[model samples]
Target: MSPTRSHDGLDIGVSFEFFPPKTEKMEETLWASIKRLAPLSPRFVSVTYGAGGSTRERTHNTVARMLRETPLKPAAHLTCVDASREEVDDVISDYWMIGVRHIVALRGDPANGVGQRYQPHPEGYASTPELIEGIRKIGDFEVSVSAYPEKHPESPDVVADIELLKRKVDAGATRAITQFFFDNDVFERYVERVRKAGIDIPIVPGLVPVVNFSQTAQFARRAGASVPAWIVKRFEGLEDDVETRKLVAAAVAAEQAFDLVDRGFRDFHFYTMNRADLVFAICHLLGLRAKPEEVAKATAAA
Candidate 1:
């Protein structure tokens, strides 16, 4: 039996992603989510770098605070967009200095925002693979890069996306957290293609529990992932009913996660839109219960 099955659902690993807060109220909410999820013992909790690196300072501060206040390991997202090589390297070295050893490196969306064309700074790391190389050069950071199960919007084909992933792994990425997809079949097929290409690093399936169906559809569209019709139907009548919607959203996300566990996926990464209740409930449904911090970390690392 696979380790995922043998573990009796207790030994699987999970991680979370949070974006830095922009306000005091948001900061309160963000820390609430962090503290709530901390007990589940995620392998690492990652904070996102906003498009074009707009949230660089906030990301750093949140990560630094996590390092100072929480026992949870934090991974800082680094991007090559508007910043030059020296600027980016200085940030990487700062992370190392602060004892953050995991980096999620990416070529961020265009500086202006989504839908804008991306142009690399002439003096910066030109691509994600190159950014990974720069990060590796600076420290023995455990670098993680993005993977797209539905294929990156900019890639001509899925094969090309896998080829770029191959380059990222060759450039020293230690893991790939996939862009969220609604369909498990899509993720399974993407993993097959990745392995066939000889990319053996962990391809963790990223899960986004729906806080709102319409909003989730928007995110999926931007990510080039399709929301299946059945998922659409599940939420069609719940728009005006917030309570029902939350319940249904929890059910849908839990079902997806449980199915993946059945399929032998041992690791999961959740995009926790700064909300913990939904993701926490889903994890609880998956046989995960909060333990003392040390035991939780040992279970996660198991």
Candidate 2:
């Protein structure tokens, strides 16, 4: 059977991605977001570690707490960065012990951060495919890796990017989740290329709701995603009005999401950025309803 699903867009599935909190207040906010979104019954939620294994301990504590207290399945993000094979293996084993059965395996940005030349540790897995191989050897993890709709910044071209993805597939990646894109046609084209390469794993679209337009544009620039001029025009001059910006953000996100559904996409992964209201509103616009029992479990987990 396919590890995730054959996303012909017939059956809907949504997943959320969250980062480990850096402060107690942030932690409270994260759990509250989880509680709010839980009733939508996401396929799974994922917790991310920072570049170079930073936030490692907090990530573990959060995922472990989820397993103990929530009905949601948490996918821990693991990276090949600044850590030896043994160290990475130990972390994977710990996740297994805590019942984390899924992982978002990645070749993380260089320790210095993005835009620098990526350097693999002398004793670390060299790339994402090797990371996936290592993860699978340690346990039967439902692994997901990143895909770039706009070719990765360092990749010479889209062909090379897709080639690397095929390697991840051969190395046992269960599915591919993309970076957020403002243009749906871009995602569709990327998927077509991936399919032509003979990779059938579900390529789930990642959506990021715009909380602040200028900030989102900056992030997109760094991540190799383009913010279309139309999007810029929509958020134009709302800089001072936070409330109005939010309304615009919701309308833009909703339009993007509903358009994808019309284009026949069932599986989605949201980069929640630790805020729930905008994403929740968009999902509700997509016609998803909350589940009562799941909501109770989320409250208890919180």
Candidate 3:
């Protein structure tokens, strides 16, 4: 189904994802994007944790700052990587102490990087299900877990992937955010399978605007998400033209979002990559507008 030009009265909920910045300039950029998108009143903004707990401290600081300084609710990402059970539990306790109510729990990537074999820390929670259970024991957190519509790279098959997600839900995951995919049909089929497996929690579609086609394609490969041939053709020969690329990216994401809305999907999670232009534009296209009160509040916070 093609996206229609009009979305006159659709009601859609949105959330955004950001990674902890590694540099001073990136930090400024992250907050700028936050201030720019805060007026839209996303359901919640999430900060990503790096593999092997590499960004644990940065993620904590970012999430804590967001909670203390902004009106936006932040969901912190927690991963079972190099940390032991005691350390992971301590981090969970810290989040609870700081008034954080939501966490995205996962068994993160191997310490080396993606595409490598995942070796769990002998002393840490081995899998996401274990991590979810640990979080529940530590606090009453509304937990979110990763869902791979395309099947996780390490999974033996799609069924196994669904089974893993079920384990997470059984352990107390309240929601699931999918890995980003270019084809909406892939997501639809995955959701159907998830339902058939008796996993009924909200499976929020993760939408990524292709701000840089090449970079996104690389990420898609690593994350086990497919970059459709049609999408590749759309960005063909535009490598040297950044302005056109941004326009194309916005159009592509808006179309995908509108198509999903037409398919009766209402909630969306955008992997913002710490940039607001594309996501903000796509949200605008989805019939979302900045409330006056929210705008004033965001401006004051800025």
C-alpha local distance difference test of each model: 0.89, 0.89, 0.90
Worst 10 residues of 1 by lDDT: 1-10
lDDT of candidate 3 over 202-268, digit per residue (tens): 9999999988899999988988889889999999999999999999999999999889988889889
Q: Lowest summed-lDDT stretch of 10 residues in model 3?
A: 1-10
Q: If scored against the real structure, what TM-score would every candidate get?
A: 0.94, 0.95, 0.96
TM-score between model 1 and native:
0.94
Clash counts per candidate, in order, are 0, 0, 0
TM-score of 3: 0.96
What residue pairs are clashing in model 2?
Answer: none
For residue 238, give model 3's deviation from the true position in Å: 0.6
Cα-lDDT of candidate 3: 0.90
Candidate 1 residue lDDT tens string, 49-150? 864444889999999988887777899999998989999999999999999999999998888878877899999999999999999899999999999999
The number of the candidate with the highest lDDT is: 3
In model 3, which residue pairs have backbone atoms overlapping below 3 Å? none
lDDT of 2 by residue, 103-163 (tens): 9999988988778999888999999999999999999999999999999999999999999
Q: CA lDDT of 50 in candidate 3?
A: 80
Rank by TM-score, descending? 3, 2, 1
